[model samples]
Target chain A: MNKYISIILLLTLLLLPLVIYEDNNSRYEKLSKSLLCPVCQGETLFDSPSEYADDMRSVLKEQIDNGMSDKQIMDYWTARFGERINTNPQNSNYFLILFPIIFGLVFGVLFYKKVSND
Target chain B: MISSIGIILTWFGFLNLILMCFSNKKNLFQTLVRINLFIHFLLFCLLEVGLFLDDFSLYYIANHSASSTPPMYKFASLWGSLDGSILLWNLVLSIYFYVYVKFYRATTELYDIKIFAMIILFFNGFTIFSSSPFSGCIQLASIGCQDFTLLPFQDLVLSEFGRGPNPLLQNHPLMAIHPPILYFGYIGLVLPFVIATSELFNRYKNENWIKIAEKATYFPWVFLTAGISLGAAWSYEVLGWGGYWAWDPVENVSFIPWLLATAFLHSSKTQIKEKTLINWNYVLACLMFLSVIFGTFITRSGVLISVHAFSNGNIGTYLLIGLLIFTFLFMYIGIKNIEYFKTSRKVENIFGRSGFFVANNIILSASALIVLIGTIYPIFYESFFSRQLTVGRSFYDILVGPLLLILLYLMVFSTKIAKVNMNLKKWIIENQNELNISLIISIFLTIYYRASYKFVLTIFGSVLLIIIIGKNVISKYKKTKLQGSYWTGQISHLGIGIFAIGLVLNVTQSFSNELIISTGDTVNFGEKEFIILSPYEEIKEEKNVINLPIKFNDKEKNASLNIFKNSSQQAISSPAVFRNIQSDTYITIKVIDDDKFKLIFRENYGIFILWLGLAISSSSFLTRVRK
Candidate 1:
């Protein structure tokens, strides 16, 4: 039971970074930079000066000032611009994040078992 | 006229390769292929001449060249765009084909050579049809265009120059060699795959085939290692972002193949020990080549957005078709030869050398899978949902980071494991003294430096690991004549350790911030002082280039950084780095106006160790070829 709880706790801690809210300017800048600017050829929101990027920036600042959380702001944009605005796949496509770890562990065990059986 | 010769030669080369594939006169066909390779080389020479002559009649030269451009840049411009870049790729591929035929033809299977010849023909056909540098110029009136003016084409023969290479391409000298070296690595991958697949077709049991494949793997592996290092170096120097890798799609695509190839190398070793991994070897070989093709498709597809990806159309579909055909064909072979994969002998110990390789491959393949999924997710999202969902760096970091840590753990401990059973307690008991000493040292250093507890743990682990491996290597070197492969593996593992240490230090201990400063302002960033001397502006053609001279950490030498406002009126910051053995002080300036500028100051502690590690690892591949 303790082992299971520890595993659960570790997983929650890993997911914490995804859920944590940013209240500072640097974090905001980093977040904005990761978001793609749809109007530009190949540029992030922070790097582009396209009208859409400018509008998105305005929205970001507006939400931040209004005490809106990061997820709230992200979802707001997702709703407005469709899933295209969600730069990184989030809650809906979390399996992509989990697949590698699970595969690694499974393969590690199978390989270890095969090697150990003399 | 000269450019047309390149096309004619390329067509003839393709014809010769086809003939070589079909004909019974093998020696005659091989000689013809060699001669055709010469023609390919000559064709590239003519193309270079056309570029140098500023021949506007050649469409590629007119678009990518200028009379006023420096001689070095004009030559480098050969790969600045799509058509010319394709031509360069073909040149490198032909060169590799020539070398392979001339040297390895005697020992290598004929089927391998024939298949390779066919691959060469396919690439030749693609180059000719999709991106032909020989196509006539859009503006033929300005033939022999040359000039000293900014807009020289307006004045015809007196002043008829083309636009210079892209500002981004011309910014660094590394641009000239980086692409070609990378292409060499990418195209060199074709040989091993063709050989491995040919084995499936012939069912030939030649012992020399594996040796041939190993040779093919090592040389290209060296080039790929060098190419990746050069790319990271280029990014560190050129991209003002102050980061070497961003987990960008294009970066991920290139990395996937390298990972697969790494796995292939290990599995190939497994085949030597047990011969069980033969089928896995073929699969990996196919995947490595397919991943290269996938990388090519991604870069040219325009399906995903990346700063470094090429802008092209229809080529992606053609490449996708080629990929599908090859993948299905390889799949068919794999299924037919399914029984060959099973081994009669079982692994005696889980902690043996072969066992270590199995674990290593597991991590490698998993990591490759992670990268592949992360890279392809956006494409899938876009295709299925008609939504542009980007897989951010955080996703990759979360997915790949722990796996790398596991890999590092396995790497450090594998040496010990190779000599023991799966008894962790016994292993720890034997090495406890050295481990404790290293652990204490790491703890003290971490505390002294005010690093995080996690960092302390990582440092402790790496130090303990390194000490154990280093001690073993030193003792081995003293006892016996050092085996080339053994030493190379040790060096490469050491490189991995060093790189991990650098990455940990840079990520956890670095300090960075942006400040808007004016002349004579001394800004304190972390522990270092940056003094902005003065800002000056100069007009280079249509762009206003702003220069900032900075005194870093009270150093006597001042480095001047250039910032330019391009035609789009966006300020582009070019960072100047003061590289030292221990650390690097990086600074980038963005022009706010004449007197004021936005300065990004970053001090990365021990980041040089990362490059040092990469260099050490890359050079180790050379040792394999030494004898």
Candidate 2:
């Protein structure tokens, strides 16, 4: 029985992410949070209360209804306001993303070897 | 006249620090250090008096304070700006140095004391020469001031009143304590670094230095935890964002030191037990100190775009130079003393307590490293490629999130592991009942909440940790009396568990909506009805407030907008929250016209648990401090 319960739990965990889908409202929230406010320093559109942010939200809603993909919308903003508009670094900067992973892996291996050898 | 006296006292304090660095006589060194501390205390008091007296002769006070400011904010205005914040930093550093000299100096090597004094002297000199809070407009101009005009003394008097503190700062009381507590945490880190460096320079026979370093780390670690949490609380209350952390550059910089120091604390524990990771602890200590300076530089330099950044100044260049010098110095000393710590032992079992600590250190250090890189990568990218970018909340949420989950999972089993034995299979068998119960409950919660896989895993880890810790505490109490350290450690871990659960629930369940409504209008939002009452405006002191009363499901709350009557003309929205144990209903108003208003309503679940967890975790540290 315990083994059966464990298998069921494992299956549930694996299937959960696939079942979770973002609706339009959540998509709007996520997209707004991922974009920086053009007029505010270091604040996202979701957090900024300026008129500019309000206008941006309207534009975002229009784009979402126009069925623009998340990447396309991000690209549109990036092209309009340069790369700084998006809060996340662009996919072109793969080196920036990989640096932390490599750091963690190398450090983890060295630590494991040093500890296990003795 | 008061400004000149303050400057003279600062210079005198600097000179005294210089003399103490070179003094061979212990008595003279102690006396000089104490006098330096006294001078800084006096200087701080003078700044306070100037703020209260509305002394326009002092440029900092004239710029950051006003006659209309409250008494608490008047005191907070000391650290409200760039120059004055550095002065506060110097004062806190002086107090730390004096405490070290009076209590811990006899056991510490003279070289260590001198090195520490020299560091303090450098900062003292930086304040006096580069960023003196006592300087007038002319003196400030002489040091390359660009943010403000260099007005004559008569022009300052013509203004008649100073500009008050930043509107956001004066909006909340947390501003008064957060910076000072964070400064104490930042300055407290210098001692461990000094101790580690001294140990590296002179090979100590006993491991007493490790104990000293560990004990010294506790209060600072506690303070940093409380400070960071309080900062998040301040953001939640004052920023009107309905969220606590935004992964902003300033917030990330402060968090990096806390993460590194936490890593050091964990590793230091294993070092005390197994006499291993000595070199690693030394490196971690040095890195913590470096990160503090780097954080300060990032916060004050304006190299990155942050709402919390000071204006761009020459101080950034000086700080970068200081960072480079110390990096090279620590490298040289670390390499020179590499052979001294070669006799340390290795972990006998990978599943033992020490081994788990190693895992903890690696995970924490990696988290810190990732945060550090993410924070500064934009600057490096911009300078090198001339392309502007930002590393925001998504980056950290993606990279560091799994590491934290893994750390939490490790916490469950690591607590169950015995000191010297490995029997992992046997241990699992013994705790199978607790494990099964935790798994069942987490699965049920996951299904009920319809949470995603990441949150489901987080829930499992948190539940398992709490159950195991609870079981352990119960069994331990049944067997024998638990020690204070043991209880505190378990309580802190339990706090982490609760905090993790609260964070997951908050992220997954929170919802917000915006609506435009007029006074006496009713609105319905997602099964909840809101009745808007009359809107009123009032003037208090220097602020013009517009208050909108609303009844949400039988609870009356007021959401207001405050406009400060000052030169900046800043307007802040004050959010009204209907607090409960389960969730908070928050509302904030933005005036569109005389009749219509835009209100943002946010419902955040389990936020109080986050605060409670933070309080329990941080307050537990108070009892863990060693004499």
Candidate 3:
């Protein structure tokens, strides 16, 4: 009985995070945070205090009101400011995207081979 | 006169270091080394006295001090600028080397000590030649000399009082301790770098190096963690923004070294336990040391403009040359002895403790590598393309955030993996009750907060971790004795769990907005009514300060946010915070005119928990250094 309970709870815990609902306000915030603050060195638009950042925020609001998707808004900024405008790297930067995958595979293979020989 | 004496002592120490390099008498060598270190320490003390006495005749003091500056801030000005900071760095390095030699000179080889001494001597030379703070002013006759004929000192005249330290530095008391603690952490790298380099150079055929390296790395790791936390705390307080970390180049540089050192600590532990990944440990140690140099270069070079970086100068080129020299030296040695890192120990179970450590290192190293590329790529891009690019928090969060989650999961999963051969049913039954209780509590909290499942999961994980570790601690104590290493490791893990929960709460629950209000106007903010009392302005010594009195809904106590315009014509905001057990109402005021003021109110929740966890984690590592 304890084993069955544990298994069910564990499964539910694993799947819990996938089920949370996100609202539009939170979505807007996340989008704003994903873009860089142009005037600041490393700050996001959501956190910057410059008047330019405030203008960007209003533009973001208008785009959202116009029914643009998150990706489309991101595209709009990227087109104007180049790839550096968005804080998130492009999908084309595969070296960064695939680093963990490549490193894990190579490390795992080496470990396995070393252990087998031992 | 004191400044000249300090410089003379430094020169004498350098000479002693050179003589000791060839000296054959062990006791004499030790004596000379001690004198060299003692003289360097004395020089720093004299410099500090100059700051305290408000002796503007010293070139450094004349430049960085003010008659009106408070006594506490006067001492902090010792490291408030470039040359003084270098002097602080020199003092820390000399003190650390002295302590290391005192403790390990008898057991360790003399050759290694000589090499380390050479490095210290090089630092001594650099500081004296390029960045000396002990420069006497001939006009006023301060320190050691009455004339400006000395090599390092020059004739200079100034007004009755000196200019104060940078306003940002003197604004908070945290500045007094932050730079010194960070310098200690940075200088602590000398031990591992020297030990690892010598080990690779001579191919030392003993296991004692592992113990020595681990022992030496422990204090620095704790200090580095503490320094980073203190820096973040300073930012949270001083920087008008609500966030702590901005993924700025300087912040990333500091964080990168900490990550690599953390990886080295884990990998070195694996080498101690299973005799595997020894070479990887060596590689990590060298990389961590190099990262410190790289971080220093980034801050000093002025290649990247950041709030935290020192002003730009030729110091960048010197640091770059130093970094390149050490990089090639370590690489050459690493290449020569790469074969020694390979281990024959085979893991029978992939889910065991050793495997978990391997996974931890991979994630840590990857994260560090990603940040390194992100930080350095911009410099290269600008040089080649004559354009600028930025890698900000958004880039890092997307890449490193998921990796951190995985690391957190492993932190819990590792507890179960140790006894992989145990019966699965028995294991589940043993832990099931506590797990269920934690889960139920998490569910309650999640429902009450109406938070996402991700947040709930974090709570569940944290609760589970605390309970399991608590049980282990109790059981271990109940048994006749407890393992110190196990106790410390578990406590640190518990700290990580707590920190993660705080981070989650901070991310999901924090609220911030701006409100413009006039006198007698009431504004609703975050479930509280803020009633503006009145606006007033006062002029301090060098600035104009504006104060806004505000009262919370039905609360007797009032809070005020102060805004000041300084000599630099820059407006600085000092926020007022209303504290509670679980949250705080932080307000920053910007004065527009006589009546209108803009107030930015940010509610920070669970940050204390994060700070509490940080204290716990750093103290736990400190325990590892003890007998």
Quantify all predictions' global Cα lDDT against the true fold. 0.68, 0.79, 0.71
Model 2 stretches astray by more than 4 angstroms: A1-25, A90-92, B103-108, B138-159, B418-420, B475-482, B625-627
TM-score sort, best first: 2, 3, 1
Instruction: Give residue B585's error in model 3 in angstroms.
Output: 2.7
The residue-level lDDT of candidate 1 at B570 comes to 40
Candidate order by lDDT, highest to lowest? 2, 3, 1
Residues B303-365, model 1: lDDT tens digits: 777768775567888889878877887888777766655542455554666767777788888
The DockQ values of the predictions, listed in order, are: 0.25, 0.53, 0.32
Rank candidates by DockQ, best first: 2, 3, 1
Candidate 3, true inter-chain contacts retained: 0.26
- Name the top lDDT candidate: 2
Candidate 1 residue spans exceeding 4 A from truth = A1-34, A37-68, A72-88, A99-118, B102-109, B139-159, B343-346, B417-423, B452-454, B478-483, B538-544, B553-571, B625-627
**How high is the TM-score of chain A in model 2?**
0.78
Where does candidate 1 clash, by residue pair?
A: none
Model 2 Cα shift for residue B239 (angstroms) = 2.2
